[model samples]
Target: SWELLQKKVFQNKSCLSELYDVSLEVAKRCKGLPLVVILVAGIIKKKMEESWWHEVKDAIYSYLGESEEYSRGTVHLSYDNLPDYLKPCLLYMGMFPEDHNISASNLINLWIAEGFVQDVESGRLEEAAEGYLMDLISSNVIMVSKGGRYNGKVKYSQVHDIVLHFCLERSREEKFMLAVKGNYSNFRLSDWKESRVSFSFSDGLSEIASKTRKPFHQHLRSLRMTLIKGEVSNWSAFRQFSKLRLLKVLNLSSHRVGRLSSAALQALIHLKYLAVSARKFNFHPESHLPHIETLIVLCPFSRTVLPPIFWKMKTLRHVEINDVVFDLKNNKKWISEESSKLENLRILKQVAIKIGADDNVDVLLRRCPNLQELEIGILCDEDSVEICQLESLTQLQILRLSIDSFQLNVSKLRLPLHIKKLVLRGTRIESIVSSIGGLPSLEYLQLVLPTFIQLKEWCLGDVTFHKLKLLKLECLNISRWDASEESFPLLERLVIKKGHELEEIPLSFADIQTLKQIKLVQCKNKSLKASALKIKEEAEAIGGSDIIDLIVKDKGFEDAKKIITALKGKGISATEAAGFCWG
Candidate 1:
């Protein structure tokens, strides 16, 4: 418990040397409860003075009197001690269901919409919101559930059951928000005056909408229907949503509500964030949502055409569409104007652009000069499509390209110099290594799912990925990997999935001091597994025994069991061997 408390309190354990006795005493007062230790550690880490430590120690001792109420009391103390700015931000997390892995981006967007994030002089509101999330994580109030595949940043986060319960109770007391679950027959909007309402189950949506009259919803700032238990065919409730004139955030992305008419959306003038799943979206941004900032459409099965007016909305910051096709041809006249630029746009994702006689991807990209992240799908039947002008997007940091079925022209591909993360899928280009290796700022690269056939050989000859950290290769048939430690000097994690034909990882990877993890999934070669073990041993010999980890996953249970047996034979404990090998 003391060790865990120290780890939670200080990143470098040496900082606790001076306060070792006091800190140990504080840890012991928690009665060996991990949650209590963590919560107390979070509270006391901000101040290192001996007086503050004693004060915290006394407070914990006073609160943790009963064993049954110890965890709850600690949680309450943690909440009471949180900084004023973080109070609302932490309370907002109760909007999500228990055990729900909340997307960090979605949570940050909601916080920004709710005015919980303060403006930072040096950065955007999104960055400030991210800082707020990090503060919560550091305080141990929020737990990171999953890390991003590329950068290993906190992508999904959740709170423990006790913390969540405390948040729900405190939110109710403060009338900050109300989360409704199961039936809504007894739910009365007039009785509850919270500004935010989250419905865990969607069955009560229509009932609540029909029963709740005007003036009750006028004060509502946020409404979210997170989970759908059944198909909701009666979307007439959305017509009633027009009464929510003061609503700032409305998230109905869980259910596919067939055409949400423009009349219903035009009433939400104050809406800053909107996420919905619909068969078709026909609203005009200029006439309707004039103050909208973040728009997310979650219709993967249907192809939605983005309105040309979106390019002219300066208030718009982030736009994400799943399986969306940009109708640039029909809206050419709208985009042709030189003044129509998305100056404030920061993110555009999964937007399919057709390169033909009418639509030029370059023309559309040039309009969003400040775009930082872009995920585009190229639909071209020709031999190659020219996206060579991406370097014009000086602010572009993350880029993902998905090609339909043609081979990408590697020679003509010009990536942004400042790009940090890049993902290419369904683009069958054999000479991609040379084109991407010399990137000065590239950090994360993922190449997955070639269109027709996997590229047979990948030779990383002399070029270097200077800042590359994580490399992921999926559905590739590369039989030989030729490279040296010089190729990826800063490479930290290597992931290979479905690389059945791959012979072995380059032995020189063992020489890379920064390499920490090598994960192989569905690779059937025994030699590959043996090579991975050898690499682990070599990394241990050079660095320390705890430096590198080798993870193997196979579909066949027998194969995984055999690998586990081999790992145990190498002096690894049964539990550790089982963790290293998964079926």
Candidate 2:
């Protein structure tokens, strides 16, 4: 009660943050001053009532005693007497929306635009905004999620949930929204049956898809049906949809959809993102869906053939599938005009296969002049010249190769010179660095053993790559690291495998200046501590903490604590982290 009275008195007196609950404007009067917090909380509790708050504010007018100015309590008075006008300048923080993430740059620009900054001070607006935001934060009117400010502009600030709740209670008295729980029902709005509807069927099953025929007559622009238990709602089994303009985004994943029939898919000209799988059926080409940008058809080893008409989807940006077998053995087949028209394709993202048939995949790949990312499966069972030539994919950004263990000459796989991210699975690393030196823009590279294969000898000891930023090696049983890359100047994250046999940490990592994170799993190498220590020493010299996060999986809390203490004893801080397990 005393604190609340003081808050009222401060407001009436035009004081600084001496009140219990500090106002947003006055809290930043000091640099995270601790006194502001206790006083603000204390005063707020006493003035929790609405009438009291009004009286507190109204007293400002009465307390001035005929003068135009009055005390703003302790918070404002301290603010008014600041070395610079920024005390009040910082308190007027209404430019940013409540709960909005205010960027340091953004705050500086706003302050500059408002002409509230003195030009002589270096980082003038940013420094002032920083002091202001910090004051508000320390006083509990705001919070700082990100510890540091970006671009040296403004201090990060967030409102508390309780404060937001108070505002919400007052502001949302007339506006409120409540979400109804449970799966979408077959019982839909009868008035808009012809219109497209977004439906969720993750819980077991719902008869909505099956019955879209009976009561549905609207043109569906999109239909996303995912997380269902079984096959796609056998709507085709009942009746063919009128015109697929009736659908756009059709996602029937984790379900058993035999096929997207040719006739049923004819009129879907406006389709964009389609995620469906025919585990035991084939894709029948019907019409071209020009609007489709993302297509995913994950299928196991089966007879589900891709429709030849898929060549007409010129705007395709993403393709994610487990496996694909292109059979071009028909000697009497003919190529249509659409087969040569692949110029608009920008992405053919991911592909997996057990066997690749003898088809002109070269001619097929040549059509997408803007291809950016590709994941090819080396499933050349009977075919030798599988991936012929992809020199045309100049815009290729990411390439992943998931190959079977038996396939040899893994080095034959090639990529565009400016690729960004490359991942290799079930492949040997003979001249990994040299062979990959052609990639000028490569930022990330991941090499993992798919099926318990030991990494015998990867002469990565003699090559140099100037642009590799991230290197991830997992699940490969190796005893040593003979890597000799010219200090990956921008490498950031290094993740070692869990439950793998590794004798020591890579000594090559000792010189990388930009290295930021290193995660160790089940395998703790003999040099792990030394490597961590070196990183700590380097980070501190560079004015930052290298050991930001440490996760010790499959270790007891006590043992984890011991390991952490040992590291901290070595001057490298460590913490035990927990992962969320969803049932």
Candidate 3:
């Protein structure tokens, strides 16, 4: 059914219809596999075209055959394809139950530190994790999607119930997948005819504090996470060990360690990625774990914000948050500030930051040199200030700004080479765009419409962006469309939405030779709907000589009266497109 709908409807529908159809298709495919659906959606969005439908359909068909053995929604084929090394890794996830949303970065680092994804070609754990998850998702193994509308990328990932059942079943053989899942209460020792097992529960810590006691797990390789909320005297999850060799990633991020005890530090001799989020995490840096690679301190601020100076744990790659009283507030604070400065992070320009008047943005940016994509959360509430000189960022390719009031010395903030995907939202920054240095490479540009904007003022006069393509806008209250300089050599999609004050579209863009699509939407306004009719007439008058795609952005039924008025002189259907949505 989805294949048929995609073939017959999706391509020719309005933006809303397209989204609706795609979403339905994705939901149906999930079959309780929410993680798989979300992951597939992201992979599909990377390259959108008619081929997208074909590829998605093909992938689904392939997935159906793989996990045929698993009950209902569980994917058996994908499970069968898991490599020997990765099987233990996937089963390890059983520690977390259904609806459990874990941060992808934190989980990946734990996996890497456990000698899971050691074959790092680019020398980046996050990058390698993204690739690994992409493959898993494409194969219909998991899901990924945004949890909320935070104007940024998705953070938490929820797992399916069926996926958990499979993981628990597989863990019986190796005795892995033990840290979480209600502190291993779900796994009864009688159920496991295994003596050489690990203990990771609250009772162990309770015993350790009451009496210098320790529950040893000689065969335990790693403690993925310890998710208790309050204070515990010993290790938040893992208590003791005897012959554990690969005790790599220890994430006690959200637990309270009353004091950084020497005994706890001594147990993790082979630790690599240690994400310890406690109230008083004042343990010996060097003597405790000399080979630790990534040490994270999660606070509650979330990933959208990065804090000030972090502890210089020499072997650490990521850290975040500030736990002054020993309680971890913001999870993002655990990510080390030092990771951004590493020379290898030049390729990681997709930085998400909230820069305010109090923030020293200039100092913060100095750490990130090869920034390609910058998603800024700016709040210019008091004491309006100018942001850092963008010219220093020689490699910024994409810029998405959410500014309350962005005061930039535009003169000195030069556009980096090959800039693409520029998005400006919720701002009244009336400034001149004199020279956008890399105009050619820009493909997608989104501008949040204000009540009034000087259209001509932002023009790069008589300039043709040969490479400029898709441009989108939402709830932008502009007066008219300015195609007066619409010389986009290959413009494909132009989308404008939810404008209350839009009277007309720029007459200049009607005869765009290469234009393939134009989309418009009206929200809560009758006057704007009438203007849309008028604009359609004006646009048709110009469209008479071109094969451009005409989109009508309007609300309410433009019945007999509206049609008569629109076609009074310009005889064209304001409601229909001959082979498309011209009706």
Best by lDDT: 1
Off by over 4 Å in 3: 1-113, 122-127, 138-164, 179-213, 216-341, 344-364, 370-386, 394-408, 418-421, 425-441, 448-477, 484-498, 504-522, 526-572, 575-583
**TM-scores of the models, in the given order?**
0.90, 0.59, 0.55
Top candidate (TM-score): 1
Error of 3 at 494 (Å): 4.9
Q: Write the per-residue lDDT of candidate 2 for residues 131-230, one digit (tens) a residue.
A: 6555555444445556421112234555443344333332223222111124556445453422333334443223444455544435444443444335
What's the residue-level lDDT of 428 in candidate 3? 47
| Runs with alpha carbons beyond 4 Å of true place in candidate 2 | 1-196, 202-215, 226-240, 243-245, 258-263, 267-269, 285-291, 300-303, 330-339, 352-359, 382-387, 405-407, 410-413, 450-459, 524-550, 561-583
Ten contiguous residues with the weakest lDDT in model 3: 323-332
Superior candidate under TM-score, 2 versus 3: 2
Residue range 385-447, candidate 1, lDDT tens digits: 554457789999999988775555545777788889999987664556667886788999999
CA shift of 63, model 2, Å: 28
Clashes of each: 0, 37, 41
| lDDT, residue 473, model 1 | 87
Model 3 over residues 1-583: C-alpha lDDT tens digits? Answer: 3433333233455434445555566547645444454434434544455466446645565456334332332344346555566565566566564567767666676666666676666556666775665555444455564432212334556556666677766676655554333454465433433322334444443332243322234334455444444635355433443234446655555565544432466666777766665545444423445566665554333232222222223354443434222111232343335453533233222233434554455655556565555665554435555544565676677776665553433334455556776776765423424344246677777777432346422333555556667767677655544445355656666676776556544545544555556666654444444444444445556666434444554543444445554565475444332212222
lDDT for position 446 in model 1 = 90
